[model samples]
Target: MNADHADDSLLICRTLGGCPDATRARATGLDADGMDFAVAVAGIEVPVRIPFARRISERAEIRQEVVRMYEQACDALGVPPRSAERNSRSRPGLK
Candidate 1:
């Protein structure tokens, strides 16, 4: 389910602060939902769509599992611990 703007502020900030190669922040205007803010991430308008607690829990579980798997793989392959997180996110279905 979608979230109220207040509950999704941190997420919005993070999304805005992500690796935007070079894009102007334009006040394009309200979307169908009348949101006051929006961004075109990698060419898609991803406004705040915070999931319910259950979904958040499930995502956390998936993240932990992925981190564990990546850590194990890194240890087995003797890669650095600092780099496992990147690999974890790169794994399919983790995002």
Candidate 2:
């Protein structure tokens, strides 16, 4: 994959990794506009697509946009953010 695609993939993975109920969710697609995720619900796997509030023009904005989407999803599901542990553990020198 190209550099931009790889970076976007990582951002998507990190974002979804922070979602508590996304164990069964898989990213299906991504673009400058938004991303698509396949999530399991009610014994069925459905696509959950989230578009950014505005077009993202730079790679630096991907993380923020992804985080925003994650927070929005968590709010909609009435769950707390799940990335705290993951983020801490992924750090270079944190315990």
Candidate 3:
């Protein structure tokens, strides 16, 4: 696998915590490989809100606009947005 594929596999494994070779397995329809690819394309939406002094007010509006745009694009592509789990089990201080 190429670097990008490896990265996606790593992310899939990290997030889903399934069989290590599941991502490498062949995709026979909507299986692990297909789901990995889809998730790589349309990842879980984690809303980010950064506070900057100059554009504080504008940032909120821009953030909403961008989120709306992303939702519209996902709708057009027929892929649903994956919501983040309330409890993340990943190591703290890690991205």
Candidate 4:
């Protein structure tokens, strides 16, 4: 990831709890409008593009958008948001 996309990438990873799937996922590209993820589905690395509803010009908007996306994904999967306690517990050496 480049400097321009580092923050957004971090936000996306954290909100999604690393990745939605375990198949060698990565934030391959990002722009002011959207992001591209390289994920392996069925042993094939596919490029998935997620576009923003509106152009995001500032870094502050990243968190909100990531959270919204994460929540939507969780709802779609019929799972609850990963709680702070669970997150902390799951991470090694975290208190």
lDDT of 4: 0.54
Overlapping backbone residue pairs in candidate 3 total 0
Runs in model 1 lying further than 4 Å from the true structure: 1-57, 83-95
- Candidate 2 residues lying further than 4 Å off, grouped into runs, are 1-23, 76-95
User: What C-alpha lDDT do the candidate models reach, one value each?
Assistant: 0.34, 0.54, 0.32, 0.54
Best by TM-score: 4
- Give the alpha carbon lDDT tens digit for every residue of 1-95 in model 3: 23423332333333333332322321112221122222221344222222222332443454443344334433443445333323653422113
Q: How do the residues 1-95 of candidate 1 rate in per-residue lDDT, one tens digit apiece?
A: 12422212223223332423312222233222222334445666644322222322343464443344335434544445545355453322113
Ranking by TM-score: 4, 2, 3, 1
Please say which candidate is ahead in TM-score: 2 or 3.
Answer: 2
Displacement of the residue 56 alpha carbon in candidate 3, Å: 12
Residue runs of model 4 more than 4 Å from their true location after superposition: 1-22, 84-95
Query: Looking at candidate 1, what is the lDDT of residue 33?
Result: 24
What TM-score quantifies how close candidate 4 is to the native fold?
Answer: 0.60
Q: List, residue by residue over 1-95, the lDDT tens digit for candidate 2.
A: 23333333333333443433333555677789987766554456667666787788998887788768656654554445556446542422111
lDDT string for model 4 (1-95, tens) is 43544333433443343444434446776678877776555577777677765788898886666667655554554555455336542421111
In model 1, what is the error at residue 36, expressed in angstroms?
37
Q: What lDDT does candidate 4 reach at residue 30?
A: 65
TM-scores of the candidates are 0.26, 0.51, 0.28, 0.60
